[model samples]
Target chain A: MRILVVDDMVTMRKIIKTQLTKLGYTDITEADDGTTAVEAIKIAVSSGQPYDLIISDWNMPNMSGLDLLKAIKSTAEIANTPFLMVTAEAEQKSIIEAIKSGVSNYIVKPFTPDTLQEKIKKIIPNPVK
Target chain B: MPIKVPKTLHPFINAVEKTFKILCFLDVTPGDPIIKNHKVSDKSISGIVGMVGSKYIGSFVISFTAECILNIVQKMLGEKYTEVNDAVSDTVAEITNIVFGNAKKELADMNITLEMAIPYTIRGNNHIITHKTDGPYVVIPFSSSLGTFTIEMGMEPKKKDRRG
Candidate 1:
């Protein structure tokens, strides 16, 4: 499945990309922050190359992952895009907010690759296998 | 439930170990903590995050030498960083966020609620990060294949009279 991994930290984006690649998916793109992620999503959606899923980190420097999710969900062109949020913060209020914002899944930092795969499967069943 | 004052930096240490193991694929074992000045060298990177809640108020900092930080960044990002630059320092900040975020989640599981602020990054040689709390900062030294780093925590019980 085509995926977009967004995080201000290149380390984090790399880690997610590596894990996704391990899961048998190679069509992955990246964005450093929410603003760029929005643009990438728009461009992809406009070109009929929309991503199957988005994995974004919360608490980035500029706009956050939540903001990107909201932006995508608000746009009719990409509103159906599935989103997964990754965050170091475990605040229940923020998790609730992401849920309310319509995130397809949520994973906290320090999570195992198996857990990540499970979340991916739930979001996009049998993703790349 | 009542708030319990922390007497050790174990939570922060565990947070560090857990974070690096998962994110960088390194198993970090922290050495015994030492109470020392919260100063860092000019060629070091520090990730700082403030902790505030009804139970506790303070900050968490992670310090890394230029060589040490570049090593981990390369491991995590797969890029060679010769010096501590603006781009590579984001690793320290995310490490700070993960350490503090994990600790706060652990505390919340036991009914202690704490709030975290945005993590700030500091770079330079021989610069000092002043702790909001008193002296004798709890500095827990840790080592990995890359190099050595320290996790400093300054914590204090919240004033009883304050309410938010």
Candidate 2:
């Protein structure tokens, strides 16, 4: 039930967190950039409170979402954590790269709560009902 | 050879229109996109994200004037922002992200998948963006109550030999 949401924009992070909360996810954490997201993930794993899922933005200072996703997948402890990339870039090349990098799912920007709910259901192990 | 315009252009236009209405609260009408024969300012209040795909490799830019940015930020926050502060600058970046993100979904329906790069803002005047490659550049212009903004697309279909 623990999830991590990463993005540089404060408003966007807030909006996505709000949506996740509405979807009944209570154990959520936020990171502003890729570096922070990575650090947070590492700390969580070591502390035995590993995140169940990660939803990250593409562009960020220091490290990007793709880099963060790659980092997560490479680590043995949290490699299988369901990771979703939420970004504004919808070019075919980026999509292919994300797939190659092993993203669990991908969603574009300005998406509705319903779209998010559907995507999460597909990836999350169990429904919150 | 006549270049094929990706079918995603229409939905991209629709998404742009919707974003303007929701974020800027301005009614927008799409006009014919013009490719300026002369150099345009690269130093405007613009947000840009790079798009890489099987068919294209280039950047998408959303250009606005200082005045236009101020107006939109003020509306978005429901407060009067006379100048570009941190909040206003962040707002501008978020606005472009939303516009591009929405367009990506519409494009996906046509099997044209894309991923968003990080969104960055260009500050200054008379900034020039040159495309050394031989792909089609699309410049879309929109008119709104606050002012006019341009969505400049400089994507060339990816060549087979080039590594993505």
Model number with the top TM-score:
1
Instruction: Point out the worst 10-residue segment of candidate 2 chain A by lDDT.
Output: A120-129
**What tens digits encode model 1's per-residue C-alpha lDDT throughout A19-118?**
8877777899988989999999999988988899999998776798888889989999899999999988777888999999999999999787799999
Off by over 4 Å in 1: B1-8, B37-43, B158-164
**Candidate 1 docking: what grade?**
medium
Candidate 2 whole-model C-alpha lDDT, 0 to 1? 0.74
Tell me the spans in candidate 2 whose CA falls farther than 4 Å from its real position: A21-27, A60-62, A89-101, A125-129, B1-15, B18-27, B40-44, B49-59, B66-81, B94-119, B124-139, B145-147, B153-164
User: How do the residues B89-113 of candidate 2 rate in per-residue lDDT, one tens digit apiece?
Assistant: 6776787778877777666767666
lDDT winner among the candidates? 1
Q: How many backbone clashes does every candidate have?
A: 6, 17
Candidate 1's displacement at residue B124, Å, is: 2.7
